[model samples]
Target: MYFISTSSPDEYSTKVDRMIGENMDLTRDLEFWMSKLPACLRALPIIYLSIPGSHNSFTSNISGGSIVSLDSPKILQNLEWIYCIRHIMANWTKNQNVAVKEQLKAGIRYFDLRVSAKSRENNLYFCHGMYSCKVEPVLNEISTFLETHSKEVVILDFQHFYGFTQQTHGKLMQMLLKTYGTKLLPYSDHMDHLSLDYMTSQFSYQVITVYRSDAARFGQPLFWPSASFPTPWANTIDHNALFNFLDDKIKDRKDNVGFITQIVLTPTLTDILFNSCTTLEQKLAIDFEDLRTGWISKQTPGRRGVNIVIGDFIDLSDNLFTKTVINLNLKLLRDLPKRMTSPIN
Candidate 1:
């Protein structure tokens, strides 16, 4: 049980009493965990909440036959003509094992969406090293989930875009607005004041769409800018380096903004070439499972603490990765008073 240094024993006990009285069971209600959160926890700013996310979230559909996306490295793009090379790229690029709807059911609230506009095509597609399925169907899946699970909130982070003109950006923005309508939470400068209770209960807003592009500035208020959610990548293959990078980032987290700790590792070209026959999960992610789980178990959520923690192949290890991140919210009960100050309407 990790407690914040500022928490007093009396305050901790009182908070625990409230939580027990509310009968909050995170493990039992993994599908609708946010709806089951204690009132004290729900009242805290959303930035202070613990959320589980997947890196390259839509890559599950990527395969050897898929077109190599423009955002991939030139080497991969050039050699994509070869079937074996494409297969290798597919293995390394595909991060999530399940679809978006399944991920939502397994307690993942944040989505790392990297999209690209296919040449001569009107539809948008999600991409990593290679392109995946069309984007609209996936968005429909998420929208359907939120329709039934009204109490749950989800963060749709459009982190990267490839081969898109100004017109294409507009088309995508329109699609988003049409799909979610009033469900999208409008951006606010006072992010610390926005909580699950404030958005869901008062406004019925359940989606936070983060579009990382200059186009977002000229688009609708529903599309939040990237600065509101600064997701700094660790960009390291070594587990020790990744751990240190996460610790340092958390210590220097900016005020009044959402932060994402990307727990996935990036393999160097040499490592990728040497392990071409193996998938990124077997060659890298699985090897660091123990260290990753240990680090997540020790995290706490707060204004400057862990917020959105993302990983690769999140469905692995019997969904323990998502479960551990969700349970971190229980720690906030001990320090609820610190977060209950002057929440913005």
Candidate 2:
């Protein structure tokens, strides 16, 4: 309906102001958006990849660096801690309630417990459940738990810790297939920063995973998909009007493969995003537009075949890449307006 805007001078062109709400209550808007989770789950599951969308200044998170883009230089050593905290909190909270309720009904007593501060030594970080102070032992313990537990327990690696070279990624993929009987639910949605689609689809304990990739761009507060009608961002330009923007960059060359070594970054992208408002809705649109301009294109039909990767992690050809840390510190940052808002809980 109404997109929010920021106090920035360029709010009109960026449309990031869409983050503002109909009533100017950021918290209410956030809750309202997150509350729509169950309805989406009733349908099928897809791989979820999150990149930095646009900022919804009205909210608590200033999103950036997405899984589809590239990992920021800041995360050289810090990613482990941030990802661990987020993954546990999200996974535990979201599933804990369901697990506890179901177990209580079934007469089970093993409620999921939060890692007490006492249990977790100060300054000692835990990645996907492994405390830095006790990585090997903790992993062993979890491995033991998996052996005894009936349900599946997935241990996802944010940045391959035990060795994540290109070689390691391949090895890990192979191991997952061998351990889980092939075709593990590796992804949920392609590029959604605010949802848990990646982990939720995994309802088993036969395997664990370490995911890698970079989201080229980030943030999206209000993205009117090509399929959605009546238009969500009524006051904004419909760049996602797929047909209008669709150009045959690859034509009908199904037999030839190509590489996106060059990306024409349009400086006008910010203006396009906020063409109308400065709400989360507007910033999100701009972020999406940036993502489209900077990355995400067709594969060239080539003799060697194509290998599609979700995360960019930078270093891939490095022609015109944005090197910025794009994670959400919900407490420290404010959300911006954009085309696609983070998914609801």
Candidate 3:
């Protein structure tokens, strides 16, 4: 719900033009859209954005197993995310601000197309088979852009790719900060959902942000069924024990590295959070799971779950917790720990 649209005024004009082209009136649908925003669940301190900045008001917490209810599969507010993507794609073609457009496109390429299957399978945290192509050039372009323009640039590498500190990504940030005097913006996304501990003590800070994707992207609910295709289920689990362990790993690693955190929530859960768009929120509540359960033999199809929801890669405040990752997660993890434990809890 909290869309950190840093798109310039030109982007706005483009969007408005699209609205006009669609023959839809923004004023007429103002309240309608507002109503579609998510509402915070009563039980938890979940944050929903009825309007811009509303989400900023709510603090973030990691939701482990209960990812966007596997039912909807449509990323939380899929239409909105898609809209933003299309908007960026539209601008990526021919915007006056070439730098901004390119940067935005790089972001889209990284978050939208690259990090589709982002998830923590075991101890690895993050994986990247999804991106068969190298992202080096994109990183170079982004670094150059940041070095030239952004003030306190925040990378916010949302577990979108594999390792932010991976040589390619690390060097890009270094080039930017080193080439220009601008300090590299810290990366902030999901720590548990990524494998960043391989870097040196301070290296991860420059490369990775804490995991907020799980909360902002996955923690909440959407819609899904009991059994289905290649796998009977869609969503696995989003719970506290897993989050607690992941948080501990992140906390333990805090000493050597600096990081930013994000939030996660499901679709229906997100609808309840923002409370911005009432009708859409309600419409999303429909049982998408009930509708699609069983084999994909023209009957059931995999739900396009909320894979990623990116935010403006900008800093909020300077003051932050400086905890030493006393209990390093990487060290404790066993290759397929769950396999040794019989049935994973």
Candidate 4:
């Protein structure tokens, strides 16, 4: 028509940019929406929600120094038996491939940390049979992540300690307190009511420390007992048995106590020798996919879903397992507004 004139290139570009921003798919960004969840919804008990977690979260670098090797005779070391055992150690020792920072970004809010005193070095190391990185660097990485994501909360469960004396435990506690200080959430009887919003509001970056040993609790008000947070480990080689155990565990939910359902398949000595050609990643990929697609989906509606479902290799290549775990929590978010208005039992 006579009145129709094309706009300038810059003007057209600006219009397109505005349209894209307005129609942005925010649902894809879990962390952004999680941070912006309504205060009323945030006030709900944490136990009622599905929390994403990682098992043996600090074993990303399990090799070399972390390898579990037996001090044997030179003759024994040269035998094929010794070689097989070394290969087994490589497979069994590595439980995770994602470091702390990467796991945090993938919506992992709970971390199962096992620390041990290294005989060769005068430092605390994260141990899953063998030792990995020093405790301080991992703590620093977590601290840095918390600094950036102030709205998030993380649980640091020191559930196991090897080669540590009472004094060593005390020293570790001192280091922890010194590092986290006020960010560490004090031990409380009312764990259910501890909402993410409340925690972040109270402490800038909240970290709930669960200490397993009684010796580590000396004068440390922040240390929580193993009873308060129970993570029943499935030490079985059978995938069917593992699923059955996790299913039964999920059904039995406690009020104030934190529960963990271990989702990863445990490989015994026999598994390693038989499946030596296959890596841990390769072995778990198919099982993880099946569980995410088949078993996990059927857990909604009647059940509260899972409290915390942890696994090995949490940060898989595609992060499919981690996303599945996070999506479990989204189902609760769907009913947040309705639940927020309902009466508390």
Candidate with best lDDT: 1
Largest TM-score belongs to which candidate?
Answer: 1
Cα-based lDDT for every prediction: 0.87, 0.25, 0.23, 0.67
Mind giving the per-residue lDDT tens digits that candidate 3 earns over 75-142?
43244234433232222111111122332322221121122222342111211111122233434544
User: Could you estimate the TM-score for every candidate?
Assistant: 0.93, 0.21, 0.23, 0.81
| Per-residue lDDT of candidate 4, residues 1-345 (tens digit) | 011122665654454354335434323654543465444445655655556678888877876434452222344334525555555555666788878877777777888988877657788888775557789888988887777778877889888887788889888888888888888888876676577776887556478889999885567788788877778777886767877887777677566677777777777657767787776777764556665445665554213347667777766646666666555544543443334432212
Off by over 4 Å in 4: 1-27, 30-33, 38-40, 69-84, 300-305, 333-345
Q: How many residue pairs clash in each candidate?
A: 1, 99, 72, 0
lDDT of 2: 0.25
Report RMSD for candidate 4.
Answer: 10.3
Off by over 4 Å in 1: 1-25, 341-345
What lDDT is reached at residue 343 by model 1?
23
**Model 3: residues >4 Å from true position, as ranges?**
1-127, 132-134, 155-236, 250-256, 260-345
RMSD of each: 3.7, 20.0, 22.6, 10.3
Clash count for candidate 3 is 72
Output the lDDT of residue 330, model 3: 17
Q: Cα lDDT of model 4 overall?
A: 0.67
Better of 2 and 3 by lDDT: 2
Ranking by TM-score: 1, 4, 3, 2
Residue 318, model 2, lDDT:
27
